[model samples]
Target chain A: QQPVQSPQAVILREGEDAVINCSSSKALYSVHWYRQKHGEAPVFLMILLKGGEQKGHEKISASFNEKKQQSSLYLTASQLSYSGTYFCGTVTTSGTYKYIFGTGTRLKVLA
Target chain B: NAGVTQTPKFRILKIGQSMTLQCTQDMNHNYMYWYRQDPGMGLKLIYYSVGAGITDKGEVPNGYNVSRSTTEDFPLRLELAAPSQTSVYFCASSYRIMPFINSGGGSDIQYFGAGTRLSVL
Candidate 1:
């Protein structure tokens, strides 16, 4: 099953902070995050394993909650470059070879 | 070092027509996946393969078929195309490195193609 992401859309001013959440009904083995700009393929951000480790890339960080089967991406000091659609892909405990992406969250960072 | 390459960046197909979206990866990754993204929506998996000669269906696999004849190529075929199938298609591959870490093959970081935009009239 596909993961569910919160905040369908959000607008932020420069330097503002925002959080996007992704929750799955199945047991999550790992969570992957990516950002997609207009007319561009999705770019990898970071991956968090089920060990509850928080992974970070630049000002963007993500936390995985194994118990809750959820993950959250945190963006601090947002930049115009951060404006794009954020997606969370989940690898379930079922050992599926494919990563199921979430519903997606559109984030726009204005200058 | 081209990560992933997709041919026919943009295409328009008439109803009931068929076409194949070609995807090739030079990274020689063992895993490949096909997904479709509608405007303002998240990606939906169409099919995936673990390696050559292995394929499986994903969340939304209807109206689509795939074959992984070689490790470098995984093509998605759309038959009897409909307007609902018109969307941006992406092909991705992952190495699935560090198997000893997370029991489930650790982490998989997927490298994506530029994507093909298809419109069915």
Candidate 2:
């Protein structure tokens, strides 16, 4: 099943912070975060494996809660370049490694 | 490096016409996938292949068919196009499992193509 993302859209000023959440109905083995600017393919951000782990890169971070079957992405001190839609792709515990993408969160960062 | 490339960036078709969306990856990856994205929705998997000569259906494969005859190519076929099939299609490739010892995990990180936008009237 597809994961659900909260806060369909959000607008922020430069240097602000934002949080995007992804919830799955089934347990997940791993979660991947990506950002897509308008008219471009999604760029991979980070991936969090199962075991309630957390991973990050620079100002972007993500956490996966195995027990809750959910993951949250945190963008710190956002920049104008951060304006884009974020999606979380999940792989379930079934071990099939079939990816299911969340609905997505549209974020706009103002100058 | 042309990591992944999709043909016919934009196309238009009639309701009963048929067409193929071509995809090729130069990375020699073992896995490839096809996904469709509606205007405001996330990508929905239509089909995937573990390797050459192998293919499988995904969540929204009802109106799509796929074939993976070579390692570098995987194409999605719309046998009978419909207006509902109008959307942007993306082709992606990934390693079956990360190979490096220092790699984060066994998880597969996908690399996507520019995408093909199709509209069926």
Task: Provide the lowest-lDDT 10-residue window in model 1 chain A.
Answer: A91-100
Could you say which candidate leads in TM-score? 1
In model 2, pairs of residues that clash are none
Q: Which model scores highest in DockQ?
A: 1
* True interface contacts retained by model 1: 0.83
Worst 10 residues of 2 chain B by lDDT: B98-107
Give the per-residue Cα lDDT of candidate 1 at A95.
53
Provide the DockQ value for model 1. Answer: 0.67
lDDT of 1 by residue, A65-99 (tens): 99999999999999999999999988777654446
Q: Model 2's DockQ? A: 0.60
